[model samples]
Target: MGTSASKLNRAIMADIHRLSLNQATTERWSVKEAVEGCLRHGIPSIGLWRHKIHEAGLRESVRLVRDAGLHVSSLCRGGMFPAPTREERQQRIEDTLRAIDECAELHADSLVLVVGASSAVGLVDARKMVEEGLAAIVSHARESGVRLGLEPLHPMYAGERCVLNTIDQALDMASPYAPMEVGLILDTFHIWWDPYVLQQITRAKGRIYGFHVSDWLVPVPDLLLGRGMMGDGVIDNRTLRGAVDRSGYAGPIEVEIFNQAIWDMPGNDVLSTVVERFTSLV
Candidate 1:
C-alpha cells in the first residue's frame, strides 16, 4: 500500500475507538501479551476469558490490565445453568457467583452467559432449570455490580452447548428481572440468519450489554472452531454493526473468534490482520 493509504488506514482505526479484542480471537496469547497487543495496536479495550485468569493468578491478571491501561469489555462467560441433579445445579450457581466477584475485581463491564444445553430430561425441563439458575444468581451479580449478559448461541448448538438460541427467547426469560440484573449479548455469527434479527435488535435498544462479531463460513469443518475473520466469510459486518450503532448501543464492539487456523498463527500476526480487517470491513 502507498504511504497515503497506510495513513488513511491508521486514521480510520483511530476513529474506531469502540473496537475491542476478545482474548479468544488470539487464543495463544497470555493475558499480559493480549493486553500488550491491544496497546501496541492502539486498541483501547479487551474482553477476557476465565481460564486465562486462572492460568495467570486472578489478582495478578487484574494488576496486569490495570498497569497496561486497557478497559475490559466483558468476561468470556459465567453460565452453564443446567445440571443433572439439584446438588450439581447449586454448584454451578456458586461458580457463577465467583465469576461475578472476579468481574468486580477486574472492573469488567459485563459477564457474558451461555445459558445451557437441553439435556436428557428434555428441552422443556432444561429451560426451566436455566431460569431457575438465573434467578439463583442474579441477585448476587447485581449486588456485585456485574450485569449478566445472556448470549443466544447459534441454533446449531441448541442440543449440546446452549439451549438459548434466539434473542427473543432470552429476552422473554430475562424480562422479569431488572435491566442491570439481566441483559443480552448480540453476536453477528449467531443472529445474522434470523429474519427478525434487525427488529429484535431494535427492540433490545437499551438491553444490549455486549456486542460481538465474527463471520460464518461455508463447508465448515468444525462448528466450534470454524469462525472466519471479518470479510473472510459470508456475514455483512458493516450492516450488523451499523444496526447496533443505531440502536443506541454505544459500548465497545468486540472481535471474538474461535478458529484453529487463527490460533495457529503468531499472535502478533493474527492481531495485525484483525485490526486491518476490522478497519476495512467492520
Candidate 2:
C-alpha cells in the first residue's frame, strides 16, 4: 500500500471499535440473524429495531446478543407522543414505558425516540404532547436505567414523522430533564441540512446519547425510506461525526440506511458494504 493508503487503513482499523450496525440497515434480518451477522463481520455493537426483537422473541434476542458479547448501541424506537384523544395520548405514554422496559432488558445504551408528528392538533400542541409524554415516561426510564434519546427528523418530516426537526428543537425539548434521563440522538441524514447543526451539537455537549449515520439521497425516492448509504449521497459525514466527537459522544456510530435497494441486497453483502463505507466515509 502507498503511505497514504497505509495510514488510512490503520485509521479504519483503529476506529472499527466504534462501528455498529443498525438492524434496519439489514431490514430483512431477524434479531438472531442480525446478531450472528454482527459477529461474522467483527462488528462490536448493534442498534436493534423493536419489530425484529419481537419477531425473535425478546428473551431470545437478549440471549443472542449477550452470548455474543456484543454491545447494544440503542433501541430503534420508543416514542409517538401525539394523539387526538386523551385516552389515545395515555396509550402512547404506556407504549413508551413498555419500550423503556425492553431497552433496560436489552441493556441497550439508549432508547431512540422518533417522536411522532401531529395530525389532529397543531404543531404547537403536538410538541406539548411530546413534552407531556416525556414527562410521563421520564421517571420510568430513569428508574429502569434507560436513557431516552430524542431524535430530530428533517423538517420535511415535521408533519408525519417527527415533530422535533432540528438539533436545537431536540435540545430544547430535552432541556428540562437530567442529561441521563433524556439526551439527543444525532442522525446525519436528518440534521445535515440545518445551518446551526454544528452549533447545536456543541450545545448538546454531554447530552448527546447516540449518533446515527446515513446519506440523504437527492430526488428522494421514498420520503421515509430514502436514506442512502454513507458516501452514496450528499452528506459530509466526517464533519458531522467530528462535531459529535467534539461534543463528548464516544459511543457507537451506527450505520442506519433505510433504502429499499440496499435492503434487497443479501444481508452479508450489506454488512460488508456498511463496514467498508463506515470505515472510509463515516
Candidate 3:
C-alpha cells in the first residue's frame, strides 16, 4: 500500500476513541442537546464552551457528560490575556483560573487557550503580555491537574482574537512551560496558511496536547465566524493529520467550526454532515 493507504489503515485500526465535536459547530444545540448528539453519532468526545456550561448549569452538565461517558477533549477557551491595564490583565488571569476549575469539574483533557490580541501597543508587546499571562495561570492549572493547550489563531485574527498566530510561535511559548503542565492545540484551519507548518508540527511532536480540525474558506467572509466544514475548504486535513500522527501525538481530533450558515440548519443535520465528512475526507 502507498503512504496514504497505509495511513488510512492505521487510522482505521487505531481505535479512534478520541473523535470529538465542539458545540460551536451547531450553535443552535444546547449543551445537553450537543452531548446527546455526540452520543447518537457515536462520537466519544467533545469540547465545551464556558457559555454553554453556564447556560446548561455546571452541575447538570457535568452529570450528563459523566453519565453518558463522554470525554471532553478540552474546554473551548480560557484566555483573553491582552488587556489595557495591569488590573484588567490580573482579572483575565483570575477568570482563566476559574476556567481551569471548571475543566477539572468536567474532567476535560485540557483547557484550550486563545491568547488575546494586542492592545493599542502592538503585536510584540501583546505577545509578551500573553506569555506573562500564561505563566501566571500555569501554576494554577498544574495545581488543578488541568493541562493548558495554547491555540494559535490565524494571522487574520491576530488583531482581535489571538496574538499567537503560528504553531512555531505557540511552540516557542509552550516550550519552557513543560508538556505535562502546558502544551499546544494544533488546529489545521489556523496554521494551514503558514509556510512553516510541517516543520513546526515536527518540532511540536510530544507537546501537541489537542488537535482541532476545520477548513479555510478561500474568500473567508467573516474571519471569526466563516469557518468551513472539513473537506469543504482549501485545507488538506489528511496531510495535516499525517504530520500529527507521525509526531507521535495520538489524541482526540476535535472538530470546531463557527459558521453561521451551518448553525441555522437543524443541529442533527449539521452533526451528521460533520461525521460523514470527517470519516470520508479527513
Candidate 4:
C-alpha cells in the first residue's frame, strides 16, 4: 500500500509540472507577488498579463521570473484588431507590436490574442479587419521570435469583447500565416460547448500554441467574470487536454479562471485549490 501511494504521489507531481498559474486567476497579485507565490506552491510555469508586467516594470519582471526559474507559458493578450477608424486600427497594430517585443523579452511561448469586436461593423467586416490586422503584424511577430496565439472568446462576448468566437474561425484567420508565425489558443471555457471542437483541435495539429482551462458555470452571474474552477462546473477538461496532446501541443496547461468569488480569496489559497482541481479534473 505504501508503494502504491508513492507512485500516485509521483504521478501527481508530474502533472503539477505541466500546470501553470495564469496571472488573471490571481487578479490581486502583482508580477513579483505572483512569481513568489508560484515558487512557494511548486508551480513550474506562469502566464503573464501586460498590466501586471508594467506594474512591476518589464526589466524587473523578466529578472524575477528568470531568477526564480519559472517558464513563461504565454503572454495574456496582444490583439484588438477591429476598430472604427483606420488611424485607430493602425494605433492598435502599433500597440501589439510593442507587446510582441515584451513577449520576446520575457521568452513567453506565445502572445495570446483576444481579437476585438466592433458593433459598428458587421461580423464579416469585423473578421476581415482581424485578418488584415494579422497580416500587418505577423511579420513583426516572426521577426521577434514570438508566436501569435488567436484566442476565441465564447460567443456571448461577440458584441463587445471578442469577435473571434470559435476554434474554426480562429484557425481560418491563422491559415494565411506559417504555423510558427501564428497559432490558436484553445480555452476550454470558450470551446468546450462546440460540437466540432474536438475535430478542430485535431486539425490544428502543429498550430496549437496554448491551452487554457476554466469551467463554465450554468446560469452565469456576470457575462465577463463568470468563469469557474475546473470541477466547479460541467466542462470535461481532461478530454480537451487529451485532444490537444494528440494534436502535437506539448505546452503548459494554464488555469485561467475569471470569477469574482475566486478572486476575492487569498492568492495562495487560490493556487492550492488550482493544484488540487488540476490534478483531479484537468
Best by TM-score: 4
Expressed as tens digits, the lDDT of each residue in 26-83 for candidate 1 is 8989999999999988888999999999999899999999998889999977878787
- In order, candidate lDDTs are 0.89, 0.91, 0.87, 0.92
By lDDT, the candidates rank as 4, 2, 1, 3
Please, what is the TM-score per model? 0.96, 0.96, 0.93, 0.98
Top candidate (lDDT): 4
For residues 87-162, what per-residue lDDT tens digits would candidate 2 score against the true structure? 9899888988999999999999999998998777879999999999989998899899999999998989888778
For model 3, residues 105-188, the per-residue Cα lDDT tens digits are: 999999999999865757888888998999899998998999999998888888887998888888888889777888889989
Q: What is the full ranking by TM-score, best candidate first?
A: 4, 2, 1, 3
Answer with 1 or 3, whichever has the higher TM-score.
Answer: 1
Task: Give one digit per residue, the lDDT tens place, for model 4 in 144-236.
Answer: 999999998889889887999988888888898888889999999999999999998999898999999999888887888999999888899
Worst 10 residues of 3 by lDDT: 9-18
Give candidates' CA RMSD values in order: 1.6, 1.5, 3.7, 1.1
Query: Which of the predicted structures, 1 or 4, would earn the higher lDDT when compared with the native?
Result: 4
Total clashing pairs in model 2: 0
Off by over 4 Å in 3: 1-16
